[model samples]
Target: MSNTGSASFLRELNPNRVEATKREALLENPGFGRVFTDHMVTIRYSEGRGWYDAKVVAHGPFSFDPATLVLHYAQEIFEGMKAYRLPDGGAALFRPDANARRFRNSAERLAMPALPEPLFVDSVRELVRVDREWIPRTDGSALYLRPFMIATEAVLGMKPSPDYLYCVVATPVGSYFKGGASAVTLWVSENFTRAAPGGTGDAKCGGNYAASLAAQAEAIREGCDQVVFLDAVERRWVEELGGMNVFFVFADGSIQTPPLTGTILPGITRASLITLARDLGLTVREEPYAIDQWQADAQRGKLVEAFACGTAAVVTPIGKVKGRTHEFTIGDGNLGLVTARLKSALLDIQNGRAPDHYGWLDRLF
Candidate 1:
């Protein structure tokens, strides 16, 4: 992974921009990821040239050959994060450097050239700086940033591509939990496996998400909000939800989550929760949690809360776990105290309402 800090070069595009009047109309009810900002960042890469052609340009589509490797082989990866508008009229990115590092890790895992860390940060900052006006000021809202890389090589071979393209896009988003942070229902999948022992679960790749859509559709059809996947090998140990990591809160004030067992995404929110829990003087553990344990604990009043964490939801309470033969309801089927406290603490830090004792926020504009 390249540790370079910032890009040495940047170019501005023509000022023929689209006005935000129509966008503002959408922002009033900007239900997640529906409306996009006017600008985007892009950089190109080849074996000999490395990463080049860094620029901020108008938001538009790109032409790709029919034989593009990504279209055929699915050689792509991406990262999701947010930029918050502080009350002081400035913008901040939460743990952006960590995202950069994880982006590089995802690139390396996919056999793609890693963009220099400096270039990555520079692209994000430049885009957010230009589109700072799009950062939503309402509570529980943010400017969602998506950075992605795709193999652009027009070849038919099964080998890795030598050419790639990296781009960043932003969207104004509202709270993921539309009504409120109420408890959610989950569907347990016994017929599908999200990842294997040596699979790309450790990387945030498009294919991983694409593979989960069928299971997710099944969950929704069964009247559940999300699908919980188990380990691919044994299909017993708990893994994660479709797009988020899982957490379990005990009645004794302790917390636990499934470990990074090479079949789970290492979420930034997951890591932050561990730190926050430790700071709150709660004992936290990372281990292999079984689905049966959750059901048994809820039955015995030992497991008080269950939630999922990611960039989109931040933190969401899990009220019920529904499987083929059993259904379990946790802690009166409502949000628990530990879950509420952790969510508020993380939000406060991101929104500049609390002290950033860990320096997790980076001022971009």
Candidate 2:
């Protein structure tokens, strides 16, 4: 499955099939990532041919050799974003090009072939176009898109694969908060680190999440909603949550988030929140926020609100920070005014209720 750069070819699935009732039932709940849409997009890449064989096919499994490079060396990268159906029946993607750019960056970082921007954008557009109805119109619901690339060469010597595969799959998702937006508890993981200095933390890859799952399981057992990781070097400065970026609101009506210290995932929603905060006339700072500093401020009444931001949850308030022997509760253990306001603003822009001042919305249809 190699492609010549100038060839215009896409193999369409002959069956073109879907189970209607089953899909409907799944969409009724559409719990995140459990069920997939009817169709998926795929394109192949090789050392000599680049990316080719772009096509939309029925969602199904792939047959891969046991010696596939990705199976051994894990030369893979992925991204997460969403598409929303607006009131007018049209669909929109929140800064999809930004995701595309980040996908390319991740590929470069992992020594995988960069899927051309046009192909990447077109692949997403085609998927959304075919599966537009799968995009939920309910509030706080969307069609979650997962785009990924895997090295597919059938040798496992650890060198970059001569062949690669890039794919996009989508799943309808309901509100990340099962009931409603509520304050969450976080466990400080002083023993385990999600990413180390000069690591793949900045990339949207699966290994990082896989590495954090153990610590996340421990946090859950400890009655915390999420795990907060510290810098691997000193285990002092706060990096981020297991899957999201952290922010702090101070008594002085200012905001602070851990700076992008090369060991943190520069979340797309995190950057947008910073921009929106500035637009809302709030003082915002990005620096090394230490765990000690967070506790000290909570005691001094300076840390008023805390939250985590990601594409999945949008924004969630952090009600309490619990460590092995210490616990600090923030702002009555409820969603603060600033946290609620920011979440609403971002959601409004996402749902097409508020103006997209930053030109973040990209219409898919």
Candidate 3:
């Protein structure tokens, strides 16, 4: 799938044949990534034919050859974002354009065909419109959208596949953390590093997450909720968690997050919070923070709070840090004021409870 050009057409719509009725039950307790909607969008790409055969079909299984290149080489990438059910009984997407750009970046990094930005957003829009009812009405709940592309060419000898498939699937989710917006514990992993210099750390791909699983399992064993990784070179500077970006709040009323040095995921939610924090009269800084500094600051009461941000988790407070050598609690081991305020501000904008001062919400209805 080498053709990297813009193409447009009407997608063939094939709605779900069955009428959905378990929505209330699912919405009541739709845990993260468990309950999916009834329809999905798909688009195909070939070396000769740019991008074609777009369709909105019923959610079902797909058949593929055992020798498919994606099965072996893992030439695939994905993006995670959400469609929020607004206060006015409508639907909106939060910074989907940013997700579309990141999707293209991931595609370029993985040697896959680049789906046009318009095409990408349009595909998601169509899917969400068809399954708008799947958007959970519960506060702090949304329809999680996953857009991905995979290498489909059967003849594979460690080369880019000539055929590609791009798809979008959505699921109604409540909270990524177990106990709703409660604080969480983190396990600092000194043994495993998520990405190295000149690696695929910045790209949103499957392999990065797969590589973090071992460390994540270790965190679970340590009775922690998530794992934090340090830089791969010196192994001192704090990088990020398995799937979320980290932030720190000082007792002097200031904020700092690790700068994006082509080694961090550059989370959309992270960027949004930076703006929102500034609007709320808080100083936000993007800088490299060391693990030892975090521990020292917390111990001395200089660092009052810490948190992680991502599309799935949104804004989650980091209450405690359990490292192999050291362990400490941030503030009172509870959700801090800055963390709660930032979460509420972002959620208010997303759920239409507050004005979208930055024009981040893209209303679909």
Candidate 4:
């Protein structure tokens, strides 16, 4: 719903494309964000002119000045979504309009110009169409698309850039984590908070991720796969994982997650899972969950299952939790019935293995 007028994209094919044989070999075992497609989409925005000069060109890098605003001030935001290989031998995207709406929200929060929703979807459509051959048909594999915006103006002052670049690049991805769907252990961070009220924590920005790396490193040192953050004010409530939203399953067939209060990212996948869980007639609650209460519930068998959801990782079961002075395992430290049911329901519709009753799939030839 942005005011930027319609953009007419110009296509420019890649002069040096990988041969089909090599491309096939790459797609066979293409891990997450490692192997990219041949082409990409780029659109520019100026303070006065709005969005302009849209193009689909060969995949490559850009040469920017050292004073580039994004490099110095970290004015950037990005979204991750996927294109699925359908059962009928076609490609489709899941919930792109939702991504577009979130993208605009991120732009506004970062003091950047908004791109029209139609242009955003059209740009993705163009790039995916140009590189449709790269869509992988393997289980849990698809073309992962990264749409991002960066402040491009060269300056030294601390302010929003006049020039910005919006681009979409895709990679053939099989799994986000090396463990695949196997359960992951989380290290609870009492020292670091992900976002505070009136902060960029709710926005999908580069700074927010950069802020989590230190806590993530600490987790890895503790032999954990990921880091989970607590609320900034209290440091008692569980907010979210470093990059994904978390949900807890109880024995009564109820689901609960940390609410969105301008401090947690409102994940599209998390929203979808909430809907699908409720569709099964289960009660899903969006409320504050304390870390100590979580461990207590898990120990007493009140919490049966817990999982994290996002675009790249999909729905990942969280098995164990570790902190400075406490450690506990959830639901026998294995995938539970509720987690599996929700995951299957989401992935089945995504991969076209089952009927899409919600009309979530936007199929492409």
lDDT of 2 by residue, 1-365 (tens): 32322234364753755566766777788888887887899888878766767788888999999999898888999989999887788989899888988998899889888876666777787888888878877787899999999999898596988899888999999877655688999999977999987899999888899899999999999988899999999989999988899999998989999998778998999999999999899999998888998999997898999999999888999999999756899988899999999999999988888888888988877
The C-alpha TM-scores of every prediction are 0.97, 0.95, 0.96, 0.98
User: Compared with the true structure, what per-residue lDDT tens digits does model 1 show for residues 123-221?
Assistant: 898889888878887788899999999999998989899999999999999877666687889999999989998899989999999999999999999
lDDT of each: 0.89, 0.87, 0.90, 0.92
Write the number of the candidate with greater TM-score, choosing between 2 and 4: 4
**Better candidate number, 1 or 4, judged by TM-score:** 4
Candidate 3: C-alpha RMSD after superposition: 2.0
Name the TM-score of candidate 4.
Answer: 0.98
Instruction: Give the higher-lDDT candidate: 1 or 4.
Output: 4
lDDT of 2: 0.87
lDDT, model 4, position 101: 93
**lDDT (Cα, tens digit) per residue for candidate 4, span 1-365:** 13454567798999998899999999999988888999999988888777878899999999899999999999899988999999889989999999999998999999988888888888888888899999998888999999999999999999999999999999999989888889999999978889999999889999999999999999999999999999999889999999999999998889999999999999999999999999989999999999999999999999999999999899999999999966999998988899999999999999989888888888888
Q: Which numbered prediction scores highest in TM-score against the true structure? A: 4
Worst 10 residues of 3 by lDDT: 1-10
Q: For model 3, how does the per-residue alpha-carbon lDDT over 298-336 read when each residue is reduced to its tens digit?
A: 999999999999999999999999988869999998889
**For every candidate structure, what is the RMSD over all alpha carbons to the true structure, in angstroms?**
1.7, 2.1, 2.0, 1.3
